[model samples]
Target: MEKILVVEDDKDIRDILKIYLKTGFFEIWEAENGKQAFEVLENKEPDLVILDLMLPDINGLDICKNIRIKYKYPIIMITAKTSDQDKIAGLTYGADDYITKPFNPLEVLARVKAQLRRYKEYWKGSNEKNTIYYKGLILDRNSMHVNLNGINLKLTPTEFKLLEILLLNKGQVLSGEKLFHLLREDEYYSKSTNTITVHIRNLREKMKESFERPEYIKTVWGVGYIIED
Candidate 1:
């Protein structure tokens, strides 16, 4: 059975998730704070992480940053903060997905399953001719390997997905809503264009392109985004 680590400060929420995830047949571990979360990490590796954005002992973003520096596990950030900035901050720190609080348990389960599937895909290499080329950019979707100008760059999965979509559709405009749908592996996450905006910023940073005059992924003001053919 796949294991899941649930980190939240509220006992009631934690308990509910424990029962809910157990019903999904996941071997669940619970932690009330980042301290306990690390202890749990030392003991066992989980297939996915459902992390609260705020923790009493340690800021959840710090934990996410710390973990991503060494591990590539899929992290789904959960928080009460609904602002786009807050969600972007979590994503900037390496969270694979985000969910706002007062969340539906069913949505959480769907995201959990989606993240685990993506995790497996990241490691096991999908059986597709995923190496795609556009201009000087190269991407091997199966291994999530990416290169540009013959120089390799490290990219988070979120950035990879964004750039992959843009590359695949070269010259065709893709709306933020369409991008969100393609990026989300499940149907639970909010269809917020702001999420795409933040991710686009991150992708530009990794691609070493200035947002004011991007070399790729041109923003068509009042429309969407596209890359020239």
Candidate 2:
């Protein structure tokens, strides 16, 4: 059974998730703070981590950053902060997904399952072409590696997926809503364009592409974003 480590301080929230995730048949580990979270990590490695941004000790962003240094497992950040900046901050720190407070338990469950599936698929490789070469960039699906101008660049799964999609559909515009739907691996739609915006910004920064005059992945204003062939 896949294990899930939930780092949440609120007992009620934790209990709610425990019940729902347990129903999903996942082995759940509970941690009320960053300290206990690390302790859990020391003893057992979970397949996915459900992290809360507001903790009694140790900010959740720091915990996510620390985890990224060593582990590549998927992380879903849960926080009461509803602002786009808050969500962007979480993503900037390497979180795979973000959920605001008052979120539906079912949505959380769905995201957890979606993340695990994507994580597993990333490691195992998919049926798509093993490698794609465009301009000075090389993306290898089998190895889950990307290189640009003979230099390797580390990318989060979300960033990698976005790049793959853009490359596959090069020279075409894809709206944020469309990209978000594709990323979620479901048809669920919400006014969450900021998620894609932050991710694309991250991708550009890693690629060293200038936002003002990008060589690739250019924004189309009211249309969407596209990568020129």
| Predicted structure with the largest TM-score when compared to the true one | 2
All candidates' TM-scores?
A: 0.89, 0.93
Clashes of 2: 0
State model 1's lDDT: 0.84
Candidate 1 segments whose C-alpha is farther than 4 A from its true place = 123-127
lDDT of 2 by residue, 104-214 (tens): 999899889998987787778467777999989999986778999999887877888889889998988999988888777775536566789999999999999987999
Residues 1-229 of candidate 1: C-alpha lDDT, one tens digit per residue = 9989999999999988888888889998899999999998887888888999989999999988988776677889999998878998999988888889998888788888877776576566556667888778899887777899998867777778788889878889999888888777556665555778888887788788887899888999978899889
Off by over 4 Å in 2: none
Model 2: what TM-score?
0.93
